[model samples]
Target: MKKAAPVKESGLGMMPANSNSWNIETHEQFLLSELLPLVIGYAKGNRHPSSAAALASFITLSTVLQSEGFTRNSLIASIDASRMDIHNAPEVLQ
Candidate 1:
């Protein structure tokens, strides 16, 4: 039976350095530290809207509101109401 080709490890191919110059361990480190932020920002925001920016924005806003000691549910509701107000049609247009 023929053996299958070796599968590359996660983050291996994404490393910015030349694979031959850097050892696999160092490559993995760069992938985690340098590359991940770029990947997350680019890929998540562009490709996966819900899992990426929208979700992140909601979490960040929620955290900030909580730190200010606001009631969480009330703050969320207020934000939603404000969004609806901004998005709602002008009365003259009705």
Candidate 2:
């Protein structure tokens, strides 16, 4: 039988040279730093509805993920896998 592939470790891939560890504070800081810029850019692009809806969804998912102790990498991987599965599925399944 063929062996299964090893799973990748989750969370942010790697820390910056200056950063020591990944913790709650680091997660919050990263979220704020990254998301604020995205929000601003979306707003500037006049995609208010899309930006607001996405931000709301992101906030909800972030809260749920935090409560469930999920890492960003795992979340992204899961979403990507789901999208691929859907895309490759037959029309009846979709």
Candidate 3:
């Protein structure tokens, strides 16, 4: 029987390998520096209560993504997709 080859790591869908231990301070800094500003800007541009709620959700999701070693681009894409979904919802649902 032929043995399967070992999976090589690449940037696509693969979490980055971290040599250092997890640091809450660093994580907080990342949220403040990167994620929070985006959320805040979204909320300001949207100017709706639901937008504020979505910002909170984005923060929570970002924290999860950070813990999972996901990249910033992933978080940005997620937020953009969520915004699109909200804006594209049926009028009856709004």
Best by TM-score: 3
Poorest stretch of ten by lDDT in candidate 1: 4-13
- Candidate 1 regions with alpha-carbon error over 4 angstroms: 1-46, 86-94
Per-residue lDDT of model 3, residues 51-71, tens digit only: 676657767667656756778
Which segments of model 3 are wrong by more than 4 Å?
1-13, 50-56, 59-94
Of candidates 2 and 1, the better by TM-score? 1
Candidates sorted on TM-score, descending: 3, 1, 2
User: Given candidate 2, what's the lDDT at residue 51?
Assistant: 64
Q: Write the per-residue lDDT of candidate 2 for residues 1-94, one digit (tens) a residue.
A: 6743322233233324445443335566676888666767677688576668577768776756655568887666656655776657545323
Candidate 1, 10-79: lDDT as tens digits:
3433447564553435577787787666657765667865456556656765765575466867766666
Task: Give per-residue lDDT, candidate 2, residue 77.
Answer: 63
Show model 2 residue runs off by greater than 4 Å: 1-48, 86-94
> lDDT score, residue 90, model 3?
42
lDDT at position 76, candidate 2: 68
